[model samples]
Target: MNSSMDLLQNYIQSFGYDWLSNVLLITTGSFFLWVIWRLIYGRLEALADRTQLAWDDLVIKAVKAPISMLIWVWPATVSVGLVLATHSNDDVVWLGKIDLILVISTFIWISLRLISNVEAHVLDQKKRDETTVQAIAKVARLFFVTIGILTIMQALGLSLSGLLTFGGVGGLIVGLAAKDLLSNFFGGMMIYFDRPFKVGDWIRSPDRSIEGTVERIGWRMTIIRTFDKRPLYVPNSVFSNIVVENPSRMLNRRIYEKIGLRYDDGDKIDAIVDEVKAMLEQHKDIDATQTLMVNFDAFGPSSLNFFVYTFTKTVNWARYHEVKQDVLLKIMAIIKKHGADIAYPTQTLKVDPIAMARDAEQPVGIVER
Candidate 1:
């Protein structure tokens, strides 16, 4: 091996082709790097596929491009450095700077890809909403990319303090001018973290009279589709200030009704209450976990009043209405079977016929009583 190395060195020196030797060296190094990357990455990929954790797959995927860049770009940079070595040591120094820039750029690329992959994995797992995931990933990419740019600038020997000062001054000015936009941006961030509501959720704010399904949550505004199918674009800042009710989070749909029984059939009020309570308790749609109240709550002027309060196990509007209808019909059946009737509003007035006749006679003759 020693003799072979000596012979090869002599051949290169004799031909004055030192650059060719460096090219050969770069090629050999790149080939080994490529082989190692393939072996390691292939095993990791197989292992990731076997695991239930999707993030490992994302990690493997995110690593691939950076390794590939190193395998390809690093050797090229080294070859460039070798070629420049003969020109001037100063030229080789500049090559090192270029290599530094390339390395930072590659790092930024990997960072962005990692963010995207991990966010996508989380979205697939539904740990957060698509809107929140996308927003967070965008922010992460911007942050890392900014860092990479600053790093490249530092490597290029630019003064960071001056640039930062100028940027700060400009940012202050822009921030003052676009305060509303900044508010909306921060409001969107709040939604991401606080998670008051999500896309496809039904939300209503009583104070704002805003009720709709969330269609999209954007950087500046949230798009809501009303029941009439109109799209309502609301600023993200509005959600921060308003009291939003998320009915989608409710475990059950409520049913509240007041039934009036006739005064004469009040004897069946206790039986009616018992029947209604039994009906609610045995109803297939009623949620047994919550409080069920059926009692004769009040006595109206014209009738006996009872209140039925319960919750349905389902929150679907159509199904809830169906369940409500069934319970109501059953209540009516129980009332009818118990020989009681639902009361209606009525009024009566007492009149004195004798006094009316006397007044009529006196008004016609006014002279004598």
Candidate 2:
């Protein structure tokens, strides 16, 4: 290596243009680095694809660009230092700091890329909770980035103690200025820890006009896709105060209905109720272990009312509706089988006998042309 360096130095002196020689050497070195990286990265990528472990693929992908940057950085820094040496050693010192910052940035980039790749891989697996994985990835990126910035600050000869003091005071001022933003951020943290709902969960707030599927949860806001297909951007802080019901987590969907029969068929109520209860208990979709009720509930003004309250085994919205329809149809069939019909509102008029007799006598032959 020393002989090679001497030969190159001799060649530069022979040209009597060391600056140009240095630039050419740096350019050539960068080109060779790129070529070397391409060859090595291609093989690694092929190997990663062949391996059963998915982590290797993520690692290879994450390091591809950062590795290339790092390989070029060292040589460039060395060349810059050599050039700076001819001018002044004091100028050469900045090269080390710059080199350190570049190195830190490269690693930070690698860390962030790896986090993203891991998040995607886990989501593709479909076994892990996507919200939790995304939250973890965000946290990991934040941690690595903060650490990288602190390291770079230290390398730049900043005073950690004084900087921390200033940061504390500045943080208080910033917090007060961006209180809502901070609240939303903390609210997001609360969601991550408490976990009342997650991505793809159907949630609704009683106190707010929020009813939708949660698409994403970010630091300041959450994205909800409403049933009408509109995107709702809700501040995370709102979740702190509102009551959110996550129907997605329900174990069973309720089927509640009031079936009214004509008052003339009141006597058949007992048999109809018995048959409905038996049908519910035998129905495969109905969760009989849950609260199931089929009985005479009330006497309406026009009919005898019976309520069928039960739960279905599925929590899926579409599937629950299907089960509910089947149960209702079966109930109607049972009612029809018992010769009872569904009731509608009807009104009967009763007139006094004297008034009816007087009206019948006056309307016989009066005619106005």
Candidate 3:
């Protein structure tokens, strides 16, 4: 490498372009670096694809753009420093500062990209909760960004101790000015830690008209897709105050129903109740371990009312309804098997023969005229 560089320098000097020697050398070096990067990138990606571990692939992807930028940037800066060296030491000093800034920025960019890659990888597995992964990603991004800014500031000859002191005072004012923003941020943090509901979970708030499947959880808000396909942007702070019900996490879905039979079939209530209870116990979908009840609950004004209370093994909304429908149909069949019928609202009237005769005798004279 030294012999080749010397040969190139001698050739440039022979052309009486010794002033452009550094520029040509820098361009040549940058071009070679670009060529090298292109040659290795494809091989690295192919190798990463064959491996089980994802860190290698993530690293390769994260470094690609930064490395590409650095190849040209480092060379150009070095060439500029060499040119400035002959003029003023102060000019070279600024160039060094520029290089330091570029290095810090590149590091920051690579770190952020790696974080994003990791987040995508975890989500693709479909195992971890997306909300949790995103939360972690956000925290990581914030941490890296803060560190990078502070680092660059220090590299630029800024005093860290004074900055820290100023930050401590400014933070209080910023906190007060952005109270709601901070509350929402902390609310989001609480959600990440407590995890009452996650992305894709069906959630509803009893205290408010919030009912939807969670789509995304951000630092200040959560996106929810409602049943009607409407998108709801809910502030995270609101979740901290409401009673949220996560139906998606339920162990079983309840089935409660009231069945009324005709007063004439009152005698068959015991038999029907007993058979219903037995049916529920034998049902594959119904959870026998839960509170199951089929009993003659009350005597309606014109009917004998009974209630069926049970829980289904399935928490799926559609499947639970199907099971409920089957159970209801079975109950109807049992009622019919016992020659009984379901009750409806009705009334009865009775008349005395003596009162009817008295009314007929009093109205006869007007009819004759």
**Which number leads on TM-score?**
2
TM-score of 3: 0.89
Estimated TM-score per prediction? 0.69, 0.90, 0.89
lDDT digits (tens) for residues 99-155 of candidate 3:
778888999999999999999999999988798899899999999999999998998
lDDT of 1 by residue, 128-159 (tens): 66767777787898899889989999888899
Residue 150 of model 3, lDDT score: 94
Clashes of 3: 0
- The most accurate candidate by lDDT is 3
* Model 2 Cα lDDT, one tens digit per residue, 90-152: 645566577678878998999999999999999998999888998999999999999999999
lDDT score of model 3?
0.89
Clash pairs (backbone) in predicted model 2: none
As a whole number from 0 to 100, the lDDT of residue 128 in candidate 3 is: 87
Off by over 4 Å in 3: 1-25, 79-92, 363-369
Q: lDDT of candidate 1?
A: 0.84
Clashes of each: 0, 0, 0
lDDT of each candidate versus the true structure:
0.84, 0.88, 0.89
Q: Which stretches of candidate 1 lie over 4 Å from their true place?
A: 1-56, 65-99, 127-139, 215-218, 228-231, 282-291, 297-304, 316-318, 343-369
